[model samples]
Target chain A: MIPYLIISPYIIFFLIFIAFPVLFSIFLTFNKWNIISPMQFSGFKNYIRLFQDALFFKSIYNTFIFLAINIPLQIVIALFLAEILNQKIKFRGFFRAAFFLPVVVSGVVVTILWQQLYGFDTGLLNRILVSLGFGRIGWLIDPKLAMPSIAIMATWKNVGLYIVLFLVGFQTVPKQYYEAADLEGASHWQKFFKITMPMINPTIFLVVILSTVGGFSLFIEPYILTGGGPLNSTLSAVLYIYKEGFFYYHMGYASTLGLFFALIIVSVVVIQKKFIEKEV
Target chain B: MKKTIIYTILIFGAIMFLYPFLLMITASIAPENEISKLTLLPSSISLNSYKQVFSKVPMGRAFINSLIVSSTITLGVLVFGSMVGYALSRLEFKGRNLVFYIIIFTMTLPFQITLIPQYIIMVKLGWVDTYLALIVPYLMNALGIIMFRQYFKAIPQDLIDAARIDGCGELRIIFRILWPNALPALVTVGIITFMGSWNEVLWPLIVIRDQNLMTMPQMVTLFVLGGRSEGQLGLKLASAVSLALPIAIAYMFFQKYFIQSIASTGIKG
Candidate 1:
C-alpha cells in the first residue's frame, strides 16, 4: 500500500542506472577528465571550445543535411505506401509485414546491407549503374555523396516504421467522407489533398518530429559505412559526440556538445508542438 | 487498370525490400570472385563461407551471448515493467503522478548523453566486458513502464476492488486479476524490448571487447566495420545472413503482433 516500500526496487534501479548516469554526464560536461586522470572543472570552456571545433560544425552540417534529404523522401514514400496499404487490397497482411521487416532487424544488418550495396567496386549500386550504361558512381568515397548515401540507407531502413504510422493515421479518416466525395466526382488527387491530407496532418507532424530527432541522432550507419569518412563528410553530431566522449576521452566537451544538441532537440520539438497547436 | 498498377508498384517495392536478403544469401553461397561478377544467380553453391565465418569468428559464442543477454533483459523488463506499470496505474499512492512524469522525462534523454556515464558507472562497478554491463542497466525501460501503465489503467477498477474485498492480497490481485487482463500489453512490451535488446549494436560494441562476449549485432558490426582479418566477401555475407535469419523468422511468425504492438505505442502521444 505504501509508495516507497512498493516501488523502492524500481526507484533504486532507475536512480542508480538512469538518473545517476544522466546527472554524472551533466557534471562531466563542466569538467575536463580523461578516464585515467583526475577531473578539472572548466565551466563553459568546453562549450566555448565546442563552438571553435570545425569538425563539430561540419558534423552539425552533415546531421542537418541528413535530415533535409531523408525526412521528405521518407515521408512521401511512407505516406504513399500507407495510402496504398489502407486500400481494401489483397495480400494486405503480406504487404504490411514485408514493408515492416526492416524495423525489427538490427541496425547493423541494415547498415551492412546498404554498405555492400553502396560499395565502390563490388557493390550492387556500382554494378547496376555500370550495367545501365552509366559510369560507376562513387557512393561512399566522394565527400559530396557520402551524407546523401547515408541518408538513402537511413530512409530505406526507416520508411517501414513511418508507413505503419501513416497507415494508422489514414484509417482514422471516416470512410463516409470519402464515399460522399466519391459521389461528387472527386478525383483521387482531390480526395487525397482535400480530405486525407488534412486528416493525417497530425500524423505527418509527429513523423517529422520523430524522424528529425532520429536523423540528428544517427551514428552506426555512417560509423560502419564510411567511418565518418571522405574527410568526415558523413560524420553526424552524435558520432562526433561519441568520438569525443568515448574515443578521445574528452568527456566534458562531449557533454557540452550533448547539452547543446539536447537544447536544439527541445526547441525543435517545442516549435513543432506550437505549429501543430496552430493547425488544430 | 488501377488495380494492376497498384499491384505492380507494391510487388516491385516488396522486391526492393526483400532483394538485399536474397542477395546476401546467394552471395554467401557464391565463390569470392563471383561476388563482383554480374549475375543475380550463384554459379555454384557452397557452405564454405558459412563454415569459415563460424570457425574464424566466435559465431556460436556470439549467438549464445546475444540470446542470453537479450533474453535476460526481456525477462527483467517484462517482470519489472509490468510491476511498475501495475503500481503506477492501480496502487493509490501519493507520488504516483511524480513517478509517472519522471519516467516519461527519462524517455526524452537521448541514450548517447547517458552512454558515457553509464559506461563509467559500469567500469567503476567492475562490470565491463561482463554480461552484467549489458543486462543490468537496460532492465527498467521508462517507455515500457509508461506504456504498460497506460494499458493497465484501462482495466476497470471494480475488478481490483472485487479482488481485494474477496480477501486476496495486493500481489494476488495483481497476478491473478490485473496481469491476465494485461497480457496483450505485456506481450507488446515484451516483443519490443526483446527486439530492442537483440538489435542493439553500439552499447555492446563499446562495453564488451571479448570476442566470446560479443552479441550478434555487435559481431556483425565488427565484421562490417572491417575488424575481421580475412575480409572474404562470402564469409562476411554469411555472417550477415546468420545475424539476420533468426530475427527474420521471428518477425514472420509474429508479424501481426509486431504491427499492432508497435502501432499501439508508436502512435500514442
Candidate 2:
C-alpha cells in the first residue's frame, strides 16, 4: 500500500496524459471535430483524405530528402570530429564545447539565426559567396534549395550530439586491438575501418536511427526559416500535422496524419535496425 | 605535421560551428548599417535593436513566465518523479514491472501522435492560455524517472535496509538518504528536464495563445515570425539573443557535466 501510494502520482499521470491521450488520438482519427464544434462520426473520411493528400505526401517526401542528406552528413562529420577529439589533443574540451554550443541553445534561436545566414540578398552565406565572386544562391527562397538548406541547418543544430555519442563509442573499442593492429603493420585507415568500425557498429546503428527520428520530426527550422514555403518544399511531416490541427483546426484529420506518421516512423526504425544493426 | 593537419581541421570545424553565433551576436548590435554585413567584428556597436525588442514585446513577462513554468515543472519532476522512481527501484510492490514497462513504451512513442489529443484535452478542460496547460502534462518526465530508478538500483541495498531498521519511512529514506547520494542523476535529469522545457516551442504554441503566458521559445519564435519585429533584421536577431543568452551562460559554466550527461543519455535514447 505504501509503495502503491508512492507510485500513484505517476500512475495517475500516465493514465491521464499518456494512456488516455494515446487511445484518444487513435479514436480521434474516426471523428470529425473542430475544437469549437461537437465531434461527428466520420467513418474513414479522415484516413481517406490523407491517402489522397498531395501536400501531405510532399511533406513526407521532403522529410525523406532531409533524412537522405542529413543522416549521412551528420554521421560522417560527427564520427570524424569524435575521432579527432578522442585523440590526445590540445584544448579538446574547448573544441567539444564549441561544437556543442548550438545543441544547448534554443532551436528557434538557431533557426532564426540560420534564416539570416541563409538570406539570399543580405545573409552572411551569400554575402561571403558574392565577396568570393560566386553567384548568389537562394538558401531558403528557392524550392530546390529550401529543404536541403534546412537539412544542413538541422545537421548543424544536432551533429554535436552525435559527436559525443561517437566519442563514447570510440572509448568502448579496446586499446589492445589498436596496439595489435599497429604491431601487424596495418595502416591508420585500415585500423579504423577494420578494428574501430566493426567494434562500434552498434553506435553507428544508434546514430543512424537517432538521426532518422530527428530528421522525421523536423519542424522548427522549416517553420521559422521558411514556414514550409518555396512551394511547400520544406513542409515537414510534423509541421504539416501542426498546421492541420492548429492553423485549420481540423483536429480529426490532423490525428489521422499523426497516426500514419507514427506508423511510418516506427516501421522505418524497425527497418533501420534490421539493416544497420547487422551481426558482425 | 599530422598534429598540424588535425588542428587545422578541428579549428575549421569549430569555426563552422561557432561563426554563425558570433555573427548573430555582433550583428544584433551592429549599428543598422553593419547589421547585414558578413563580418564577425562589428565596426560600431548599438543597443537600439535590443531596446526595440524589449519595448515592443513583453520580453520581461515572457522571461518570468518561462522561469515559473520551467522551474515549477523541474521541481515537480524532481520530487514526484523521484518518489515514483524510488518506489519502483526499492519498494516491493505488485504491478512494478508493469509500471516500468509502460514508462519505457511511452517514452519511445513520439509526442506528435499525441499532440492533437493533448490539445483537445487542454481545450476541453478550459486549460488553454493557462499555466496549468503547460505545467501539468509535463509535470513529470519519464526520462527523469528512469534515470532515478537506474541510479537507485546501483546503490547497495543495505543503505535502505539500515534506514528501514532505524525506523525511517520509505518517503524519508528517499528524500534524505538516497536522494542526497544520487546527486549526479539528480543533476543530469534536472538539466535535461530544465533545458527541454526551456527549449520547447511546439507544445506551448498549441496550448498557449495569450502573449502574457508565452514561454521564451514560443515568444521569440512568434515575435520574430509574427512580423512584430517589422523587418528589422537586427531586432529579429536581438529577440533571438535573449533566448540564446541563458543557455550560453549555463553551458559556459557547466560544459563538462553538460557534455557528459547529454551524451550519456543520447546513447540510451
Candidate 3:
C-alpha cells in the first residue's frame, strides 16, 4: 500500500497525460472534429487525405532538405568543437559555456534574434558581406535560401548539445588505445580514423538519430522567422500540423498528421538504431 | 605556433556563439534609430525599450507566471520522480518492470503525438488559460523518472537495507536517506525541468490565451508576432531579453550543473 502510494502520483499523471493522450490521439486520427463540433467518424479519410496532400509531401521534402543540411553540418561542427574543447586548452570552461549559451536560451528568442541577423538590407550578415564587396542575400525571404538559413540557425542553437554529447563520448575512449597507437607509430589521422572513430561510433550514431528526429520536428524556427513563407519553402511537418490544427481548425487532420509524423519518427529512429547497432 | 592557432580557433568559435547575445543586449539598450546599426556597440544607451516592454505588456506578470509554473512543475517532478525511481530501483514491488517500461516508452514517443489530444483533455478539464493548464500536465516527466532510476540504481543496497532496519518507512527512507546521496541527480533533474518549463512556448501557445497568464516565452513570441512592436526593434529586443534574462542568470550560476545534467541525462529531443 505504501509503495503504491509513493508511486501513485506518477501513475495517475502518466495515465492522464501520457497514456491517455497516446491512445486518444490514435483514436482521433480517424475522426473528423474541430474544437467546437461533435466528432464525426470518418474512417480512413484523414489518412487518405494526408497521402494525397501535396503540401504534406512538400513539408516532408523540406524536412528532408533540412536534415540533409543540418545533420552533416551539426556533426562536423560539433565534432570539431568537441575535439578542440577536449584538448588541454586555456579557458576550456569558458569556451564550452559560450557555445552552450544559445542552447539554454528560449528558441523563440533565438529565432527572433536570427530574424534580425538574417534581415536583408540592414542585417548583420549582409552588412559584413556588403562591406566585403558582396551582394546582399534575402536569407529568410528567398525560397532557395530560407530553409538553409533556418537550418543554420537551428544548427547554431542546437550544436552545443551535440558537442557536449561528443565531448562525453570522447572522454569514454580509453587512453590505453591511444598509447598503443602511439607505440605503433600511427599518424594522427590514422589514429583518429581507427581508434577514436570506432570507439565513439555509438555516440556518433546517437547524434545522427537525435539530429534526424530534431530536424523533422522543426517548428519554432520556421514559425517565427518565415511563417512558412516564400512559397512554403520553410514549411515543416510539425509546422504544417500546427497550421492545420490551429489556423484551419482541422483538428482531425492535424491529429492524423501528428500520428503519421510520430510513426515516421519512430520508424526512422528504429531503423537508424538497427543499422548503427549492426555496423558499430 | 600550434598553440596560438588552437587558441585563435577556440576564441573565434566562442565569439560566434556569444556574438548574437552581445548583439541582443546592445540592441536592447540601443536608441531606437541605432537598433539596426551594424556595429558591435550601441552608440547610445537607453532604457526606453525596457520601459516600453513593461508598459505594453504584463511583462512582470508573465515573469511571475513563468516562475510559478516552472517551480511547481520542477518540484513535482523531483519529488514524484524520485519516489518512482526509488521504488523501481530499490523496492521490491509488483508491476515494477511494467512501470519502468512505460516510462521508457513515453520517453521514446515524441510530444507531438500526444499534443493535440492533450490539449483536448485540457480543454475538457477546463484548464485552458489557467495556471493548472500550464502546470498539471507537466507534473511528471518520464525522463526525470528514467534519470532518477539510473541514479538510484547506483546507490548501494546496503544503505537502503540499513535504513529499513532502522524502522524507517519507505517514504522516510527516500526523503531522509537516499535523497541526500542523490543530490547530483536531484540537481540535474531540477535544473532540466525548470529550464524546460520556463522556456516552453508551444504548449502555452496552444493552451494559454490570457495575456496575464502567459509564460514569458509565449508572451514574448506573441508580442513579436502581433507586429505591435514592428519597427520598434529595441523594444522587441528588450522583450526577448526579458524572456531570456532569468535563464541566462540561472545558467551563469549553475553552468557546471547545467552541462553535467545535459551530458549525463542525454534527454534533449
Question: How far off is residue A59 in model 3, in Å?
Answer: 1.2
- Per-residue alpha-carbon lDDT of candidate 1 for residues A1-280, written as tens digits (9 for 90 to 100): 5546657778999889888888898898889988788889888888788889899889878888888889899989998998888787999888888888877777788887787889888788898898899998899999999999888888888788889998889889999999999999999979998999888888888888887788777888888888898899998878888888778988788877877787777787788788877886
**Order the candidates by TM-score, highest first — what do you get?**
2, 3, 1
lDDT at position A280, candidate 1: 61
Docking class of 1: medium
lDDT of each: 0.83, 0.88, 0.87
Q: Runs in model 2 with CA error above 4 Å?
A: B267-269
True contacts kept of 2: 0.86
Highest lDDT against the true fold, candidate: 2
| Model 2 lDDT, residue A231, Cα | 96
CAPRI rating of model 2:
medium
Between candidates 2 and 3, the one scoring higher on TM-score is 2
Per candidate, native contacts kept equal: 0.61, 0.86, 0.78
Query: What is the RMSD of candidate 1?
Result: 2.0
| Model 1 chain A, TM-score vs. native | 0.94
Candidate 2 lDDT: 0.88
Q: Which residue pairs come into collision in candidate 2?
A: none
Better of 1 and 2 by TM-score: 2
Q: How many Å off is the CA of A125 in candidate 2?
A: 1.3
lDDT of 2 at A266: 91
